[model samples]
Target: MNRPPELKRTLKNRHLQLIAIGGAIGTGLFMGSGRTISLAGPSVLFTYIIIGTFLFFVMRAMGELLLHNLQYKSFVDFTTDILNPTIGYYVGWSYWFCWVVIGMADIVAITGYTQFWWPEVPLWLPGIICIIILLTLNLLSVKLFGELEFWFALIKILAILALIGCGGYLLITSFVSTNGIQARISNLWSYGGWMPHGWSGFFAAFQIAIFAFVGIELVGTASAETDDPTTTLPAAINKIPVRVIVFYVLALTIIMTVTPWSMVAPDRSPFVNMFTLIGISAAATIINFVVLTSALSSANSGMYSTGRMLYGLSRNGVGPKVFARLSASGVPQNGLLYSCALLLIGVFLLYAEGDVMKVFTIVTTVSSICFIFVWAVILIAYLRYRRLFPEAHARSVYKMPFGIPMCYVCLIFFAFVLYLFSQDKDTLTGLVATPVWFILLTLFLPLYRQQLKKRISYTDSKHNH
Candidate 1:
């Protein structure tokens, strides 16, 4: 019997490490932190810590599940097994849609980022060019995808490190900016005493803070392509705390310390502003290039994830079989092409209306809501796995600590965030738009099942003849 084409496990440990790092840091940290700080004040620090902690546990559960079976392609596989095929279909498609929406927003962002350097360039042109370039790279090979993400993630890491280093130097020397504010640790508390906007502001910050962690789960998706899941995955998951602290908590602390929360502009990137305040005259242009890479990195990850997810869906008979076809290089070319084609819709929107940021907000909120659903599904799947297969859970080498209890905590946290979304008109619009996606998936399931049955019957008949 001929086996189906499979993805190559050519990704090394370094690739996996950088991919995990890249996933944790997105444009949200670079571009969106200013808004979060403005809304929640210095308390935004706690917002990130709390969210990152919960998501760490979520990733642990996913790690345990993925390592339990090497044959499992990703979370969507076990989800289908532990739950039902119908749910598997919804989760797979929804996950794909989540990245698709994110990719669209990132492309729009890329256009805006490019405008900083080339003011006359049409918004849609850069978006179209980026999509094409990323598409070509992804279609080549899995190794190539891993290599690109490795470098993209490295740039982001270096940028954050430079910020922390520069901020530290300013603080130790008590450097005073042209604006007359002295760089010191007390800036975090001197102005408004941490909770500048109070608890209400802290709670509101979750809306934006959660978006910063959107791609943190990409490590789980890469499990299939990783060289050794058992060793590499645990190593990757164990470092979540340190990564969250250094990249998110410590980095933000440094920013707020050097410059008071009050001085940060909500409409602009704090990263660019921080450098400019410290006398980097060309900070705008330099940060623009960094942010451009950040956006491209995110869009690149989105394309990779969407392609793999579609392939997983097809393998399970939930999507068209054509999506399951692999190129000579073991790349999911059809899936990649389909996802990129859908992403062109963003370019179309840019042509229709020259408002990239408006589209970005709507799509970002929608992506965040979808991610919450996907996380909840993982927890639910974990609960089902523990209940149905106690022996397997007992024998598993990598166990999720306080697994059952933590699942509930994460769920409640997600529900609270969803409620927070209702408090704002823009986020509320996204929250409302979420159900339409699930409803569409629900309506299509029966038809999908019928198609699967027909495909099976035809395959059996051809084999027998």
Candidate 2:
């Protein structure tokens, strides 16, 4: 008998490593950093560090669980096995929603980045082009998708390293900007203390900071298709903290030190603006290209993830069965097409809202809320695993440090971030809107269970015959 179609383990260690890095560093760092710096001043560095530390533990919990059972494809599967299937349905679909929203955010961000060079181009044009290109690339094969992210991530790493090196030179030389402000390390605190805007601003930064880390758990999703996941997954996950600090904290520190936090443009990319302030027009252009590709990298990742997520859900009977079918190349062609179709809503959003930042802020807020729910479920699943299989937990080489207590700690941290959402106008809209997704899930779950039962009964009948 022929084996049924399945995702091939084509992703190598290098692909997994670069993908983990790519997932952690997003357009949020390149574009949204300006807004975060404006809100918390230099204290934004601490915001990145705190968020990164908590998420590292979350990844640890997920890594240990995924490694414990090589048969598990993703967190959704373990959640169903460790907990109830109902909650698994909720998480599976919610994660798909999270990536869809992020994909839309990337489309909007791409248009914004293009406007840097072509201010007169229609916003919808670039967004459409981005969706088509990403869709075509994704439909080819998983390995090609991995290759694309590998190169895209490499570009981002190079750009940030160059920025840091240039910024350090400016600080040592006490270089003067064309605007007449001198670059100095004191820029961090001289304008205002670390918490320039006080506690309220520091607290407000979490909503956006959390959005910046939205895709960090993607390694969990990619684990199923990874070659020798036991080694690749742990190696990829172990490097998250270092990637977060260097890509986010260190990079932002250099930007704020070179250009005072107060002067940073909330509406523009600080990466490009930092170069512009120093009168390096050519460098600014190059940086713009990097950030542009950064947004494309994120959107491409979204396409890859959402396709796989839908395929997972469908294979389990929680989503449409069509999504379970893979192409000859071992790609989820139907799921990819479905996700790319929805991404067009982004062009509509751009046309309707007419302001890139405004649309980005609203969508990112909703995406962050959804992601928080998904992460909380992962931690809860880990808790369930520990209680159910103490032997497995003890025998596992990749144990989660402070397992039970840390799960509770991560859950509490997620709740605190959710509470922070209500304090702001834009984010409050998202917090209120997020419940609608759960309500819909609750409504459709019964039908899904019924379908699941019918599938099982039919399979039993065929076997008996």
Candidate 3:
């Protein structure tokens, strides 16, 4: 008899490492940093550090929970098993929707980036093409998706390294730009002495900073496909601090030191701007290509995440059973197709609105709010693991440090971030609109429970016959 289809453990250690790195560094760090620096001045560096520290704990909790049972496909699976099935239903679907929104925004972003090179092309065309390309790649196999992300992430890693290396050289020589601003470390404090806009601006920076880290928990989702979860997951989670330092802290410091925080444009990418300011017009074009790939990488990860999330939901009877079926290549082909089809809404939005920036803002804010819910669910699930599975929690080798306490701390931090969202009109719109999703999920949850019960009965009756 043929074996039932399942996700394969084909992802290598290097794939997990790159995926972790790619998740931490995204378009938010590339494009949104300009707004962050402009709003918080040099103080944004501290904001990254603070937020990264708390999120690291969140990752630790997830790592421990994932390693506790190698059978769990993703955090959503454990969330359902440990918590009430209803809560799991909410988190799994919400996490899937989070990526769906993020993927749409990324598609819109890819269109905008392509227009930089081809000014006359219609925006929706590039988005549609990108979706098709991503769909083809994802439908092949999970390993192929990992391989593509590995290279996409490698490009971003090299780009950041290049920026830091060049910026360091400029700072060392005190090189002056064509605009006549001298590169120096003092640029960090000279403008307005760190916290330039006071505590309020520093707090405001959290809204954008949190969005940058939206996909950081992707490793949790990739657990089932990883070759060696016990060693690989903890190793990847532990290195988050180093990644944050080199990718966000060190990279941003170099950019600010080279160009001064005041000169960064809120609407443009700081990576591209830094290259242009230093008289390397060619480098700016190259960086644009890199940012374009960065957007693609994010969208690619979004695709992988949505498909896997839907598969997990389907296995638990919350989603259509079709999504649970795997292809001969050991991939969730149906789930992948459904995700790509939903993502076409991005193309529609582009064709309808013709204002990529406006649409991107609304979608990104909504995505961020949804991500906050998902992260909160992970922490809550971790708490339940500690109380309900004390033996397993105690025996686990990769136990979360300061487990319950840290979960509470992270939850508190999430609350503060949500309050920060309410402080801004753009993000507040997303915050207000996010509840409709939950209300809708609540309404449909009972129907899902009924379906699940019917399926269970049918299976039992067939087994008896």
Candidate 4:
């Protein structure tokens, strides 16, 4: 007799840590922050803080639930155990859909970044190149994925540190920019004061701000393949707050300090703008390359997670069996190919729309909305776990603080963000587009569940042999 194949726990502590960091700092922070800054003014700082704080609680809830049962591969599994199997099926596929939407946005962003260097190049060319490269890298092995993320994250970190360090130097020396704007801490408040746009502007920032944190749960998905779940999972989860502060809050603080909120262009990246204003001749090229990789890193993560989610769903008979097959390297080859194929549609969008930011905004809004649903599912699962197994919650080594109350609070917060999305015309399109996915899922669910039962029975009989 032979044993069945399974996911390898080849991801080490370093891989896990860097993946966590990479997930925290997404393409949105680079490509979308300029718009958020424009919308919220200096108070955009508080927007990141507020969103990060709530999501920290969400991650804590997720960490506690995932650590409680090692057999539970991801939140999808726990949703099945604590919630219902039907809802679990929905969450699993929705999560896959969430990543696909994000992958499309990344595709658009990569094209936009590429045009910075080669203005004459077609937009679709860069996206196609990126997909092929990511597909090749991801098909090799999960460790290769980890290694890719580690280097990608390192690049992002060094880039930010350089920005912070350079911005800090400008502030300390009161160095004047080529534009004649002198750097100073008071630059944040001097232009328009904090909350310049008042609460409406602060609240408006939530739509894009939420997109920045979409992949924060990538750590949870990777936990099943992690080397030591008990140690690395908690370590990664706990640092999310600090990562959010330094990478998002602190970096933006410095950017606004050197370049006032009024001066930061909504369409261009403030990171590149900061460097260009400080008279770095190659600023646009350098930061363009960084952001290009940042989008690639995000798309790479999308490839990895969508593959695994598909593999997870297939194993439980919720998806097609072909997706359940793994390559010799223990990678989900079929799933990877399937997702990559769907991503090509994004290239078509780029050709059709001929506008990157418009496509980026609409797709990202859809991604953000779906992610909120996925996070809500985790919180619901946690509440159920507390009800069914009080002793388990009591005995847990890593407990979610204020678990019950915070669950409700996070749920309400997500709903509020959705409401914010509806108010804007651009985000409103995304808000409208999201329900189509759920409606289609509801329509086909019963047929899929019927097939699922048969598949499960056949597998059980084979094992009995």
Find the 10 residues in a row with the least total lDDT in model 1. 456-465
RMSDs, each prediction? 3.9, 3.6, 3.4, 3.4
lDDT of 2: 0.87
- For residues 1-465, could you state the per-residue lDDT of candidate 1 as single tens digits? 967668999888888899999988988898889899999988998898999899999999999899888888888888876766677788899889999988988887898888887999977799989998999999988888899999999999999998898888888889898778888888999998989889899999998888889988899988789888888888888898899999988888988888899988898888887788778989888888888999999999999999999999998889988999999888999999999999998787677654665756776677789889889999999998888778889999999999899999999989999999999999998888788888889888876887556655654464345
Instruction: State the lDDT of candidate 4 residue by residue for 51-80, as single tens digits.
Output: 999988988999999999898788888886
Each model's TM-score?
0.95, 0.93, 0.95, 0.94
Question: Distance from true position, residue 176, model 1, in Å?
Answer: 1.2
The superposed Cα distance between candidate 3 and the true structure at residue 129, in angstroms, equals: 1.6
Q: Residue 419 of model 1: what lDDT?
A: 94
- Put down candidate 2 lDDT per residue, 330-391, tens digits, no spaces: 89999999999999988888877457657566666777888888889999999988987898
Candidate 2 residue runs with Cα over 4 Å from true position: 119-123, 277-279, 354-363, 451-465
Give the per-residue Cα lDDT of candidate 1 at 325. Answer: 95
As for candidate 3, its clashing pairs are none
lDDT of 1: 0.88
lDDT of each: 0.88, 0.87, 0.88, 0.87
